[model samples]
Target chain A: MTSMKTPVTLDLSAAKVVTDWTHTANLLCCRVDPTGKYVVAGAIDYTVQRWEIATGKKTVLVGHQNWVRTLGFSPDGKTLYSGAYDGRLLAWEIGLETPKPVKDIPAHQGWLRGLAVSSDGQRVATCGNDKLVKVWSAADGKLIRELPGHAHVPYCLHFVPGSHELVVGDTFGNIHHWKADDAKPSRSFEVKEIFYHIGDLAPFGGIINLAFSPDGRTLTASGLHKASNALAGSRRPVAVSFDWKTGEKRPKHESMKKEIDGTMWRAVIHPTGTLIGVFEKQVGFWNAGVPDVAHLAATPSDIYDCDLHPNQLDLYTAHYDGHLRAMRIGRG
Target chain B: MQEQHYRPCGDIEHLLGRRQFMGDLLAGAGLLAGSSLLASPVGAAEVAKRGKSVVVVYLNGGISQFESWDPKSSLETGGPFKALPTTVPGIHISELLPHTAKQMHRMALVRSLNTKQDDHGLANNLVRSGRMTQSATEYPELGAVVAKGLERADFPLPGHIATMPAGVGGRGNNAAYLGPRYASVTVGAEKGGVANAKLPDGMTVTADQRRHDWRRFANSRFRDKVDSVEIDAYTQTYEQALRLIERRELFDITREPTKVQDAYGKSELGKQFLLARRLVEQEVPFVEIQPGGWDFHHNNFEFHLHYVSDFDKPFALFLEELAQRGHLDRTLVVVMTEFGRTPRINTGYGRDHYSRAWSIALAGCGIKHGAVIGKTDAKGIDVTDRQVDHRHLFHTYLQAIGINSSSEFDIAGRKFPIADPAVGPIKELLA
Candidate 1:
């Protein structure tokens, strides 16, 4: 029997490596339970797969007619909400032996690009290329309110923690802040100098993910940075953080090292207040007053979703090359 | 018994036989000589009053058949989009074209075209010129042929106008043997119309009119002193330029009402298509609107979503406009491309060039609407029935505009058939 070679030492000071569960197809979105016992990933193959973290057993959940681009889990981890390009939102009761469809709403007009569940798990919010953000009842799939402030197609959105505020980000770099209870938006912010494509005239890029600090003081929107030519998947990853209260953007932008080729798909802030972003095949962490730390060749394909473990010592990522990877980070 | 009797005007049989004899004589002599002798003043007036026009919206780069039309949802190659029911019964297209689906009754689709050339440049030339490059002769393009065949001396505008410049199809032989006069007058391919058409700053309408009068006087005096074919051609060019200057308002899209403009979405492609309709209304025989960027080698679905959605609304509005204005019977609209993308997708989730089976759509004047003329296999990889090529489509276009597909034009003393000699028009596609 042949023995495997020793692993190479990585210069990751704040964290260490963990198991990489990598065998899914082009995973677009993923959600981990609060206890980190199981993980569910929505994939380009139109199927949602739930992985048992301890045993690595896989159960495939199927219903979406197109690519499952967005996923949200209830606070209790009993219900899984998924949105797809077919403009459908399906709520799956995950506790059952075979995941059952609790409610299916023909949500948006076109591709549903964004999905969010309230912290209370009572309300679900969805946004799509139809340029409308809809809030629905998680229990009955009833409409709550329609927020239509997007001047362009929206791709990512989130609910401000500890409040009823919802911030929706679109392809045009316009961010709308809604009160969730109000019909009109409270305010809007524009990253006027930032764009996603290679040049001003090239095709537009969508905001892939947004993150908020634990204190809700900083809000960061991350995706592909502007390029000089075609958006041919060559642009680097970029993120801009804004102060929520003052609505003033941080003057300095954080981008991954030049070694990374493709754009970043998702970003999340760690419990230690470090901004960690997932790129095409790697992840990077940016801490204030320090050189940005990046890990290259972490996965084989583009990482579309990055979720922080409840313990804050582990990082889980879903990839476009069909991978669900986990990296253990600790204060060694 | 009555046919046997001789009369001053001649009996029906005698008149018919005489007309056939004259046609045969003219055919043997030459086309130009015969045209003058055969055309009568009354017949010319009728022909002018009901003249046909064609507007070709060339979706440059091979668009994916599975995403646009002929979507085979049952196959693995079908991608994510589902086929939606069009206005035509037993026919369905990609769901992305919801607006176009409603107006499918006014359009006929040809789904089985096997052009055999996958290279963009070669296929573009084949589709536009209707024949392979010839070593002995340069053949005219579809637009050039239409322009030369349907040209009216009284019409001030050029016979054919291209909203954008040509693509992939090299610029070498656009006019070919037909010469520059019959070539397309390219307008807003980029910015959406003739830029220099507007008068210079501080130039008033009165000054423009006076300058035009002086130029015409000078040209007339020069023509009297020196006359040649070259001189005549130059004078004709000068006259056409002056006419365009006088009627430049036709190129201004702002003249359209805000409601009408909004219907077309105000995109550059939409505005160019709107300008094409206006040109058709002005009696231009042919207009080609070039909306490129279908060469999606990386993110085919994303790009198609953008391009196809951009095309759907404005195109539907254009078809409706033609029908409402009672020009449907005399104006032909076509949506086509160089070829189609492959059915097998690559790792980038994109499809490359596939020429074995594809689709093109035709509508309006003399076209059988709500018709699906051909079919592709389950995987859209092969032509299962009613296979066609560029030559057959070109012939059908010629026949749709009431042009004689078999007519031979003398180019440099060499005869050139309007359509290819080997292939004939699709008789079933014609009304």
Candidate 2:
């Protein structure tokens, strides 16, 4: 995996929206192919859309019957794996002129919320409303093992960098570490700082995503805390990081005290250890080594997911306003 | 034959005195004249239709057909929920209502409803009153009409009761021309369904009874001085309140066994539904339950995930309890909303109002069991067949209880049709 030697810097005042790409249907998730030729996003219309980086030529991939909320690309960027609310997982050959689904399987009984392709692109980890974390063979969509012990609905999952183990996040903000081949978790703990639960039900503000630093030393779990009106979508975004080896929480990135009216739907850790979180209103870039946000970039609309471009200096964000914005980081 | 059932003209007092159900209640209201109360002519033919009632489970804002009763999970606009098969074969509904699905044999579904109004206020008025709002005229709500049609003169309690959470409700302006007698009394599970129907800790029942007797004497004197509709109506209501106080046990579901209470669950809506079942048992005629907070214009699925659980089990349990207790034979239960949510989900992961096509579930009474009426196309944007509206539903509701919707009511010599004449009852739904 290519790592960014230097992530976006706020001291240089370099992050800004460089271009705007529009789709009439709102987009939910985003991913950039390693080839840097296309930026693909999942739209509310139940279609994954790919837009050419240069000419803005758009292609619609229609196979899923529901919102495609999670997307991942193979290391070669030729294969795209998508999980949708319809509980179906699809494998697509994006290298073709007309991208088509090559493999489709019923991955879960209900909403398939979280998915991650392994570093070697041979396996995929997924979790859904069924409270099951499953690892599947990426080649032919075969379930390898079902990781149990999630008492609540699992929201996000990720393969540890340079390792086969997986860390899963759930509605109660609990993170469970599972060995790739084992059904039982090696360790489990709660990120209580970013989660809110009234009781056994109406649980909101849990860990929506889990991201590991390039070196795999620190793990950042992102969601909302102190939800004032969870039903009205009122909450504040927060990302809490933990020391991987010792399981000690690093007391950084927890001081986002500004009460934003949305959730930190997703977060990604850069090679430089800067955690980028897309929230309801804007994208917040936090210095992972400190307790405060380094910079905040306002998007054209509230954002759901963000991915760094293959060029590393640029970012693509899927937004709630039916548009995907490209944020260019540079000397401009 | 139907017109003979409702004689709202003179001799109402004679008919009122004849009802054995109103014996103690009417005497407490000072509505019974001396000899007439003893030798009243009761109608034996009216027994079957007299106690028939209606219960409306109002879902407050718009309920998504895609998430509740009429899901088309494979379509582009179908959203995410799977359409699980109900107890009745060939009929499927949203998986979000699994508990309701188990009891589908007792219910009928109307899937193609085009009420035509999308705004909450407009659709609420249209859905409840069965008439579009206009400055020129207004109609009584379904609850008020039901209460007026089926309220037992013998069991005299609040005819229409709205069990609701704060803000999401329907007590005021509901009666319209039906008058205050039929207006809904706002009740809650937190407090008693009939507020303060108990004697003070210090006061004895004898003392309260004496006080009631003195008040009745005074009200009788006032009636003797001025025989007016206002006075008669006031006496009737005051007596009804007294009767409610006497039978206050009806409001306290705590009197029910712990297992019974637990079956209703701990959720607030569950308790309200328990209260509704209590009212249903006592023959209160019309009960409207408003769980509210369904205006999910944001986080629709997540919110539904949290919200539907609060009511689904209780809903299924209610039907189960009614059937077990034999009240289902005389009670018409309707589960509806102001309108349906949009098939096209918005950017906020929400759905706005869409009245073009939606659904409501009906059960018991005169409804045909396991019937599924009307159909929406592949996409639920519009009704594809047998489309019905609120007017037709209103006509059906009355017809379900043996009331002829085509009959005219002599409202103070100003004739009024019971239901809109433009449309008739949904015969396919009627037993």
Candidate 3:
């Protein structure tokens, strides 16, 4: 129930495991409201839960028949959209006291792995294991257009702020960029830094998380660097940056030492220029100005996804152990 | 000399005419010496007289019981898939098997299997051979045992066949102790027909006959020089190869209509199952089809979703075809795995191998409809009632096919029990 309000300079070396909210089951994706007043998460148990930051009050929204893996909030933060493994998209009117889905669309043939609401909140985009990107009208759940060039399963998607462009990444290291009103890919590139497990003949790691730099000049794709074996979780967290205009690749950032290891599931770049990424068992922070990364937090179980507070000093993590954790990132 | 009973497909109708032509080509030069290749009875009554056959769907690596037959959807390790209700009242399985749920009435589910061996190789050997490791002797695998016990010498097709490469799961030489005659004929899963059964290009039918005569002539000369068991084995293999060549038309499953192939779903595993059904319908005695890659030590739910979805539809359709064709009463269908995955979620977000309690299913032949043989605890962690092991499963399969489980197999001057005498079949699973 503790509120993260304190403002201090960034010092991740002093960070610690702080808050644990334990009402949800094995969470997979999470997001912080635009105002940072609430945290919403999708859990494997087929429900989406929201937690009020100041009061720690929890509300569970249950309609999905299978694992709800990806979620997004409307620009105004008044509505929430969730995509589930059962191939359904549900839009919940979150401003209501007892929020229930206003519309439920059978969205895909396979599990929906990623969902994104447009900056104007007029349309929603979703990608799934069915290997198609679908856009829907936010108001009526009407299908807009289907984009189908991704040859592999897309894991995540993000809308570039203040622009109508969308970036989608797949199980392989391929990333596709599409503009509004376009059925074909506008641009595409391979982030070779994202490693795949060749021995298993399976996708080792793909783009797990992607975010645009505050100025939109750099695109950061965070995932495992080199997975000796994906099933064994023998992977190292890495974040690779690409210059948006030039498509020039930058040096990848390693979150841990060679002796230590974890898979990075989610990452976000704070407006203050701190690169925050959550690994399997640890969270890391690297100042865009400094070369070294610092440990921001540690957990007893794997963290599946994370979102930084809009205030830029606190973070929320959805865990594989069924806990929604929040950690203050400045001055301990 | 026998009445035609049933033709496997439309293409099989032309088999007898082709057989006559091939038989005439090889008849003159002692190549057919007392052996009537492709001249066996095609009578359905003769197939019935050969007793029942079995199709073993071996899943290779252990499949998770929770994700398939006995899901514990309420536990932490229950995973994301919910238990879907089946046609049989009160019976439920994972939603991953939606199609299979409709066919539950024909299935006998044994949810409590306590085979103590968890190592992949050992468990695989135990399940396939129905015995513990022996230092001095090797027991025949399930297919080999069935082949030896039920083989029709006059039939051209091999008694035991596997739609997989040889040597997987220690099965390369599964005919251990039974010698080579009852060995499984390996066929590629996706490759519809037997490999190398067709004559080399540019070799006319007459030239192929001449080559066979020349080989036999050389073999006879070599036999005169040395009397060895290896030579006898090689001679038998040569004869079998010649027989298959005469009846190679039966192996050309592509001759089946495209509609039939589509019914089988177009997956490699689906095609294998379709071929297995055809073999069993021909009364092959035993066919083993392995749809491998169930070793999900990570991302268990994700992989199981793909695996089960790929498996469920075609399997259900195959079972329906068997029932409609009347083969369900004389052919046994078995779905088995080496072990089951753990109920504990590992750090890598997957389940590890667990052997204390698992599941295997039986249907058709003498199996009882709508039967559930054993039970697992709520968390699917242990056997709560009627725990069965590999020995019990072996016995159940034998009994289902009307074979005597107590029979002895005399091999290498020793008598070995077909099934472990210490355990017996689950009587409730029997019709």
Best candidate (score: DockQ):
3
Kindly list the interface RMSD, in angstroms, of each predicted candidate in the order they appear: 4.1, 3.6, 4.0
Candidate 3 structure quality by residue, lDDT tens digits, A211-277? 8887888898988776665554567888888888998887787854433467778778876677888
Docking class of 2: acceptable
- Best-to-worst order by lDDT is 2, 3, 1
The Cα local distance difference test for each model comes to 0.73, 0.78, 0.77
CAPRI tier of model 3: acceptable
lDDT of 2 by residue, A59-175 (tens): 989999888899999888989889998898899999777888999989998899989988888888889999998889988789888887788899999998776799989888899
CA lDDT, candidate 1, residue A275? 73
Ranked by DockQ, the better of candidates 2 and 3 is 3
TM-score of each: 0.83, 0.79, 0.83
Better of 1 and 2 by TM-score: 1
Estimate, for each residue in B113-230, the C-alpha lDDT of model 2 and write its tens digit: 9988888888899888887676466677888777766656676678788886432212344666666567776666655555544444455666555555655666776677786766
What is candidate 1's CAPRI-style docking category based on DockQ? incorrect
Instruction: State in Å the error of residue A154, model 1.
Output: 2.6
State fnat for each of the candidate structures.
Answer: 0.09, 0.37, 0.34
